[model samples]
Target chain A: MAIVSGHPTEKYVRIDRLPHIWCPGCGMGIIFNAFARAIDELGIDPKKIVVVSGIGCSGRASGYWAYDGFHTTHGRPIPFAMGLKLARPDLHVVVISGDGDLLAIGGNHFIHAARRNVDILVILVNNFNYGMTGGQVGPTTPEGTRTTTTPYGNYLESPFNVVWLAAASGAVYVARWTVYHVRNLTESIKTAMQMRGFRVIEVVSTCPTDFGRRNRLPDPLDNLRYLKEHAVYKKNPDPREADIIWGKKFVIGEFVKIEGKETFGDRIRRIIQIAQSRLRKSGSH
Target chain B: MTGEIKPGIYFWSGNDAIAEGAIFAGCRFFAGYPITPSNEVSERLSWRLPQVGGIFVQMEDEIASIAAIIGASWGGLKAMTATSGPGFSLMQENIGLAVMMEVPIVVANIQRGGPSTGLPTMIGMGDVQQARWGTHGPHEIIALSPSTIQEAFDLTIRAFNLAEKFRTPVILLADEGLSHLYERVVVPDPRDVIIVNRKMAKDPRNYLPYKADDDLVPPMAPVGEGFRIQTTGLTHDERGYPAINAEAQNRLIKRLIDKIRKRKHEIIDYEMYKCEDAEIVVVSYGSVARSAKSAVDMAREEKIKVGLLKLKTIWPFPDEVIFEMAKKVKKFIVAEVNEGQITREVERASRGQADVFWVGNYGGRWIYPEEILDKILEVR
Candidate 1:
């Protein structure tokens, strides 16, 4: 078996199915590699890993992984993963999805999961467009950007800043990185895996097949360079200021690192303990 | 040994009995929101579940409540949620998913008046059809109705049992009247009770999550068990991949329906009251059956040959029992909180052998014994 270096094992990967579904030079490949490296470096048992994905190209990552996988409906990965984690706390639950899947249809579950402080990792690949369905405008699609859906000079609409939203919604750990920073992306995933509560890492990747073609960068490599030039590290003093016609300025880094409130599991355990004690006392009375 | 049996027992609602039963059944996780008549189930469970090392959460909404319970169930804990008509409607999509994914869950719907927010606290059996066909597509459902507090406890236990055995969602259908009516319930000890756990796949390797054995029910493994299993709502092959072929679809659908349908003999449950030598039989369930039984007694005082068939298991309707009774009885009077709900099932089961009279009340009121007796007298 031809194994990708730093991948845990063949058992966790579908080796024969490689030459992945993503087009050549797509940034999702970079994100996928970083995720594998993070899992390998963490050294957690492959048997204990679960990757949940929603309906999108990013959702296909679950099928490619060797661990327990779930490819659920659009915008439903959070609740589904919540079930998996709650049922088996020992398992490492990670969710992979696109910007639209997490922010649009599944926005409710995402906020609530973070608010409840469930222990799970969410890796959101923000490629700025709905790539799998032929380059439709998404929640994160820059306003006024030309796409199949928004063909005419786009009407202005601000995109959701997912990292800030998650931070505000009580996520214990929140970070944002682009595909150009592969090492940083891997490190963020590792940190998220170690976090005790809801951790979300938003990866701004290039969708050359859809978003790139719409934006006049038909060549996939040119899209990669665009991300590299415009994306800035949290520590960078002065980064290139490339503005999307209708979206917020692209800034990336680990923006939030707050400690989690009591998790749902912990609360449940406490409730059970209290109930047991009360029952004992009531019996005596 | 000759101590007087408690006739007018302690004042406790049907919801109280269900809560107590769930606790007795070793349910440790309860997630629910407060909705009128069904709210008491949550209230009672919130207090009682904790008393036995169980957790109780009052979720923000019914959707999250069901989701949380599913989470708890997968965590290897017996879990449940309670709601009325509107809340139950909200849970339909997830309920369907649970069925397709073969996740064992128990949902208690205390029926209320509604197409939407019809009666918040009024009694109605409008959800009878919803319980059977609310979520889209073809699948077998196990639903139970209770007439008294004792039956409530008993049927709740059965609901959990059927859910675990079939790896499907089980509905405990109690109307608003029964939910709020107080009666005495005797809970059996856990050791004396038979609890069904999900069949765990012994071998992790080559484990197909959706592959059914001879019983047409697949073994379930927890998420952490090193098993690579996929779950979806789409029609799937044995390996859990979405399959489009007609044969694969037929096999999957048949197994889903047959698992519960074929076990009708084991699942069929009812209480027959003076059904023998009766010219008229009153068919009822939940709280309406209580009135039906009284109506039967009153009819007997007048020397009318009236009988009662109280349905405890409502879905996968007791067709054989009904058919047999139809041959013997002159007429079957279907009494329920809603208009013409269970009456249709009675008519179908009767197959035109006997006249089916529906004595239904839709104004958020329980059917009175006199009203049902009068209807029986008219039919007779």
Candidate 2:
């Protein structure tokens, strides 16, 4: 089996499943590599791992893994994963979804899951545009960016900051990382998985084919360079907005961290005890 | 009749009886939101479940409530949720998922007036059609209605049993009147009651979650098991992979519909009250059945031969029973809270043997027995 570099085991990957269903030079491949490396480092039992994905480019990641995988309906991966996790609390439930799938159609489930603080790991791959559906405008589409739906330049609508939204919605762990920072992204996923409650790792990846082609970065390499050079890191400085063609307000880092007192499972168990006691006392038993 | 009358048979609301029945059936998880008459069901469940080591969660909304129940069911618990018409509308998408994925769940819709939150506190059977075709796609549904509190307890147990046996979502269709009105309910011992669990694949390694066997029902392995099962809303093969071929699609669609259709004999349940040697048959379900029964009794006192065919399982409609009744009865009066929902089914089953008359009340009101009798008298 061909393994992604920096993994302890040579047997975990199903290399034959690739070349993956991703466009050439798509950063999702890089993100997938980072995810595999993170899983390897964790050394979780492959049999106990379930990967759930929704409809989008990132949704296909579940098919690439040899573990238990579910390629579910568009924007429904979270609830599907929640079902899996609730059924088998012993298993590790990890959800991988694109910005459109997680933030657009699935926005309601997203906040409720975060509020419940269910024990699941969520990885959001934001590529700014809906790449799988011919580069339509998405929830995270930047202001004044041209896309199929937002032609003649996008109206300057403030887009959702996923990390901030997750943090505010009571996610136990929230982090933001770009594809350029592969190491940081891998570490964030690992940490999110290790956390006991709701964990969200927001990965800002480049959509060279869709977002890039529309914004004059016709070459895939130039799109990658734009992400790497323009995305301002807290530790390092970058060029001013005048020099950058697109993604002028790029920022990435571990944004917020808050540990929950009790997981949803624990709370449910407690509620069951209370309900049972009440029934017995009322002679309804 | 038995010698000693059971005092445990004191008047109890249908919602309370259902909660007790669910407890007896070992339902450990309940996720629901309060909605008018159905709120009593959730309230009773909330207060009773914890005593037996069960979970009751008051969800932010009905959508989340059903979603949470689905999640809890996967956690290896008998789970349920309750709502009224408006709340039931919110649950259609997830309910469809449960049906398509073959998730064993029980949903109780104590119906009220609708189109949009019509009458919150009053009774209506407006959701009778919604119960059958509310969800998108070709699928099978098992819906039961109870006319009295005793039937509420009994049918709730049957609902869970059918859900587990068929590995499909089962709906307990009650109306506002039945949900809130109190009546004597005889609680049976759990030992005497039969409970069915979803069939588990004997060989975990060879398990195909959606593969139908001779019974046309597939064995299921819960999430914690080592078996890897994939569930999706898209048309899928026996292996649960999305299949687009016409043959695969036809086979899956047929299996989904036929699994319930072929098992109609096992699922069909109804009660015939004074139907023998009757000229008129009143076909009804839920609380409307009570009014129909009263009208039948009143008609019999007046020397009119009228019978009541009270439906227990509303879906996979008791066609065989209805067909048999239609063969003998001169006229069939189908009464309900909605305008001619089940009446249409009765007409089809009757096959032109009898004239089907509909008596319906839509604006959050129950169809009175006198009104039904008047309709019967007019037809006579």
lDDT of 1 at B365: 85
**Where is model 2 more than 4 Å wrong at Cα?**
A1-21, A71-74, A235-246, A272-285, B1-11
Query: For residues A110-227, what per-residue lDDT tens digits would candidate 1 score against the true structure?
Result: 8988888888889999888888889888878887687788888357557776776887788888888889888999998988887788888988888888888878888977876787
Highest DockQ: which candidate?
A: 1
lDDT of 2: 0.80
List lDDT for all candidates, in order: 0.80, 0.80
- For candidate 2, write residues A32-133 as lDDT tens digits: 878878888898776778888888999987767666667766777776577557657788888999999999988877998889887888999988889999
Spell out the clash pairs found in candidate 1: A12-A66, A87-B75, A275-B50, B12-B182, B146-B286, B147-B286
- Tens-digit lDDT track for model 2 on B58-141? 766777677667766765688899998999998888788787777789999999887787889898888878988888888889
